[model samples]
Target: MHPAAQQAISTLLAEGKTPSVATVKAKLTEPLPMPVIIAALASYKNNPEAITHTAQQSQPAPAKPQSQLDRIEAKLDKLLALLEEKQ
Candidate 1:
């Protein structure tokens, strides 16, 4: 299982939220592999308390280095440069 997926499950359990495969899938920013999700779900099922315990030990996620706007602007600039080069 991906670390992020494990962390998400851990956090959800800690928050007193009951997570399903669908709910965990919905919470992720990127698509995680099916096997990873299944494994995570199985881990939760086998040991619910483990997830909550790990959540308490884990550190908070770090802030993103670039915001959405910054990424969009960079992509637009590259596109404009390509267009200008073609002319």
Candidate 2:
């Protein structure tokens, strides 16, 4: 994420929401042109040293896209399948 975006995420997390990265990605995408978004992302990449995991400790909006939840769901499905296979 860009510093701006990272800053945005940290602001959200600070509010007590455990959002996903995708959510932050999506927030930046909203109503903004791609080039602007691209620039912001570039800005973020250029200063990665400044954007460590600490930003996640407190963010504005939830991270995003619910990828973690989805992954968990998929994992559970696989486990369920394995259990059925044993039966």
Candidate 3:
């Protein structure tokens, strides 16, 4: 199972062993339905590249599309100007 592979990877990492993708693939003796074992091993292998909660950024969000809002504002401005001209 994935848990077993995870344990193996964790142990290997703890023992300062840098296992390759093939090495991790060889560790899974039992037949599994998916590649969760591979994924778990990749997580260990690429931990530095993997995103984590500690790596979260604290910055403002990027700008989003505001065309609808701009159009509505233009319409409102036109209405206001029309009302002023009528009065």
Structural similarity to truth (TM-score) of each candidate: 0.62, 0.31, 0.36
* Candidate 3 per-residue lDDT over residues 8-65, each given as its tens digit: 4544555676655555555544434446766665675577333222223422255553
| lDDT against true structure, model 1 | 0.77
Native-referenced Cα lDDT, model 2:
0.57
Candidates in descending lDDT order: 1, 2, 3
Top model number, lDDT: 1
> Considering only N, C-alpha and C atoms within 3 Å, which residue pairs clash in candidate 3?
none
lDDT scores of the candidates, listed in order: 0.77, 0.57, 0.55
Candidate topping TM-score: 1
Off by over 4 Å in 3: 46-87
User: How many pairs collide in each candidate, listed in order?
Assistant: 0, 22, 0
**Model 2: residues >4 Å from true position, as ranges?**
1-29, 53-58, 61-87
Q: How much lDDT does candidate 3 score?
A: 0.55
Give the candidate order by descending TM-score. Answer: 1, 3, 2
